[model samples]
Target: MGIARQLVHRLEQWFELMGAEYAYMATDRSNEASLRLFTGRCGYSKFRTPSLLVHPVHSHRLRAPRRATVVRLGARDAERLYRSRLAHVEFFPADIGAVLGNALSRGTFLATVGGYEWGGVDRFLACPPASWAVASAWDCGGVFRLQVRGASRLRRAAAAATRALDRAAKWLRVPSVPDFFRPFAGWFVYGLAGSGGRDAAMAAEAVFASIVNMARGRAAAVAVEVAAMDPLRGRIPHWRRLSCTEDLWCMKRLGAGGGGHADGWDWARSAPGQSIFVDPREV
Candidate 1:
């Protein structure tokens, strides 16, 4: 077999040894050779389309028509913000409420406007000295969520939020996670706009700007994972030709499959998986 084929075989074997039931590589839609290499040669199937968004810290070429005003969100304001988001999106209030409440408990930062809350961005910046000792073993990348009531308004707020995150990263001196994990990181922004509220061109611009801004804040890379399709406007240009990994699959190992019946693996009862990607720079 050729070198490329050998590499693919090795990768499959390695993942299997590590107990991975499903694994697939992601590549740019424009890269036909890569697509062929993974899907044509390897026994992988097309799964989903995910758009990756990127924004360089030094580059701010995308311009917004309106300037967004950002300020720290207070405790009461955070609750209000959560309520507003629940009203706009089709999310379980109980689940979103618990998330926002926990963020508040963990000392999350919030952004708001004119006493009315549109969205919020939270982070965990302070870590113990010991936490830094083994930072290389953990993925210290930050995670944040942005929600807006309307598409036009969301665009404005997302832009301002993106800038704010970048500013925070600069002050903290940590390279954004999205930037560091590029290509492998996968970045994109998913927005839900009301029908007839905005044109496709304007909405696409806003989503692009939001993702780029978030990326600029020092992330190694950024990718937007949209769980469902939007009915209003079709897929945007920047996200027209995106792809995604296959759905993670798991199975149970019956008796004697690997060990005795008492030692058989029960995939259905397996604990949820967790992964950490610590930034080397932190070490």
Candidate 2:
């Protein structure tokens, strides 16, 4: 805990010197040690519970909404979009250009309509953290395929019942456990942002579908992380909630400035905030 405080303090000081407004971090709800270190000792406050949902590539194609048009975005276009709309996003990094140039990322995409507006998604590969640590189920984002078309009535009924239970658990504010896989690798969609109201949202669905289709060709699953306040989430219903982990987003204010809460804002101190947008890489 002492080491964590020291490391975080130094990093925060550097970010403060760089003129950043707030510092952000994220971890699983199960990680009590990290929660305590950041929230208790380091003065960070939990803000959002970003869910990691996974799905088969084919599923995205099946669920893609009609009239939605999406386009692949090069790094230059992606960076421009982020800069122009930074005001609408929370917990975003000022150095978006470097983030786009990151070698770890596969590519970035944009969802648009009539060439008037765009939304971007940065894609990354979920590599094993370390060699000794074996691959787990979520490493592939939990693949799901719908093939009840040729199934017997009994089999179809069983599948329906299972899905119903999953929905029920979600409504109760819990996760539907994921099937873990060994030695898995796949694509992870990060930094999804959309504006332009319903027009932008509809286009976002096609963008997600494109990622899903690409993953399908590689025989891998794709995962997307987003907060509840993100409107684009309501447009994509094909992704399944992973019961295995919940992204606990935490933040802490830097200097003595700012309005409302001078000491800083703490999400853990009250109900989850209605708005949240912590980038996955920051966590």
Candidate 3:
């Protein structure tokens, strides 16, 4: 086996020891070798497409509205906001627990209005403070979910929360929130966004604005890996500004691939399979 294949084997073994159900990796669609390595010998089945959005610390330009409030999120409130997010979207049963755990972790912020939680943004902040924060807003625009409860109005709430973050970013003058997470400085926003409701499109736009504003407040630049083909989506009339960094692929292993479901299938006896892979970064 080649070096890459050996490395993948080692990784698979390590993850298996950690009780991983299946292992997967993401690579740009333009990278034919990586595509082959994962699909050919790694035993990952293509599942769905996912996109990555990135914002640099210097490209932020949107301005926050005149008035807004910013507050740090407490653990309890953060958990509540996380639960609310879970209620709004559909997540894979296998990945829900891990996702929730990460969301409620320390690197999260909740945006509220009129003393009520309106939207929450969570990011993974660790070393490389420059890439410190990669956040996602719960409600952007008028749409949040199919069944939103309580007094929080989607669009208005989202706008208020977004504006607050923008203001914070401006006060920090870092050019990007994610960059703040890095110790040495210079990072950007990277993650995914999806909306489900009557005003999904509008919500998406608000998400974009909020993201840009947050970046600009830090004096940073933003790059989005958009799945939408609509001309109105993203920075509007400037789609090329964002470059494609990687193509996320959904890889699935059939019939008890791992995670306590592997008893029924015999990996040694089955024939290897292949499927047409598509870029997940589109949406």
All candidates: TM-score: 0.34, 0.58, 0.48
**Span of ten consecutive residues with least summed lDDT in model 3:** 124-133
Candidate of highest lDDT: 2
lDDT of 2 by residue, 1-283 (tens): 4777999989988998999667878788999999989889887777678776666433223445555554566777667656664535555667766766665455666555543333233221122111100000112223333221354666556645554565565444222222223233566666676656666667666677666656544534566766766666666535443323367778777765323264655334545532344343442
* Candidate 1 wrong stretches, greater than 4 Å: 30-32, 53-115, 118-283
The alpha-carbon lDDT assigned to residue 199 of candidate 3 equals 32
lDDT of 1 by residue, 1-283 (tens): 7788789878777777887655545455667776666667664555444333233332333342232222334445545444443344422233433443442122222221123233333321121111100000111243433322344655566655655575565554333222221222223332222222233323334444444454443433334333224332233323222234332322223222333246654433344321111112211
In candidate 2, stretches whose alpha carbon ends up further than 4 angstroms from where it belongs are 1-23, 29-37, 58-63, 113-180, 237-245, 254-283
Give each prediction's root-mean-square deviation over alpha carbons. 15.3, 12.2, 15.1
Model 3 TM-score (2 dp): 0.48
lDDT of 2 at 83: 67
Candidate 3's displacement at residue 223, Å, is 4.6
Top candidate by TM-score: 2
lDDT of 2 at 253: 70
lDDT, candidates in the order shown: 0.36, 0.55, 0.39
Q: Which candidate, 1 or 3, would have the higher lDDT against the true structure?
A: 3
